[model samples]
Target: MPRRSYDHYCAVSRALDVVGDRWSLLVVRELCSGPRRYSDLFADLPGISTDMLAARLKDLERDGILTRRKVGPRAGTAVYELTADGAALRPVLDSLSTWGTSQLGERRATDAVRAHWFALPLGRAIAQRIPAGTATVHIGDSAFHYVITEAGITHHDGPAATPDLELRFDLSTATEVATGVRSLADAIERTAPQVSAP
Candidate 1:
């Protein structure tokens, strides 16, 4: 099938033509954490049907937003990762994350949570307040690590080798911090989620 578009020439419309699908940006959000195997993506994304996931992945690839790559010396598996053009969407996602914060009142029974989903919010919060370093965030059984530098922050799903700091927070606390309901320091003070320095 051919790609759909409004046939409009405006830049915003053009960008949306590439990313306007229901799950397109979420797929980008998943990739933002790190390269992920096909199954990895399918698993993390709770409600996306297998077919829809496949379609979105293909669309993202065709649009040059992400690429499929072989991993390991054996080439036994493949993973999806963002291209530079795709990675540039981080600021956009961040803005959305910030904007959407207000609407997050509570997680209903239907809501799904993934610890690594908080990576960007945590990265942004830490980056603003602290100097360059790494932090391994422990959110319950799940954990992820992120690197902070002058350029920006990026994360992967798992613990870091030797994170300069370690932070532990529950999902609610994370939500509060992520949504701007609570500042990072305030969240730390309220919940007193463990924060340790190397």
Candidate 2:
């Protein structure tokens, strides 16, 4: 068998060349929800410094993976969004998110940790994990019913008994696990979350 070289493969190399950096993949993930300006992007990614984000955006724009559009006449009011080619990566991003969540869910060991889950992709993914039927979820003091239907999981706000599965964790832990920062295994081993049997 011949040795595979990244440099020799145009297709593989081209994909990497476009999203070769560490933050580039995260940039793609952030844009998966929708388009946003640089400020919004930066706000979501607190750990990323301004200069580094600027560089990554520039590189992505140069590689045609992202498009920078002026929002208005005001200077520095530009929104960076994924191009058509970049939009094609949605499935890949979704798969990554799903895999990360599964791993985290499996890793959560104890039954006492609290998780503050963010909306959008993570919340949607979490909704899919419940057994198909009528149920409710109690995260901390909050509670929402998980009504399984042909469409998907729908939340109903009403007075309900203790949920079948109770997840507890702080805001940072929840976001970290949801965002793939802390694997479920790591959270279980570290934070010790308890997932009740349904």
Best by TM-score: 1
User: Where in model 2 is the C-alpha error above 4 Å?
Assistant: 1-6, 73-76, 102-198
Off by over 4 Å in 1: 72-76, 189-193
Residue 77 lDDT, candidate 2, scale 0-100 = 82
Candidate 2 is scored at a TM of 0.52
- lDDT tens per residue, model 2, 104-181: 554344433322224333345455565455544444564444455565543444323555544555566556656677
Question: lDDT, candidate 1, residue 84?
Answer: 98
How badly does each model clash, as a count of residue pairs?
0, 12
Please, what are the lDDT tens digits per residue for candidate 1 over residues 18-131? Answer: 999989999999998789999999998999999999999999999999999998999989999999999999889988877776676777888998877777778888777666
Q: Alpha carbon lDDT of residue 45, candidate 1?
A: 93
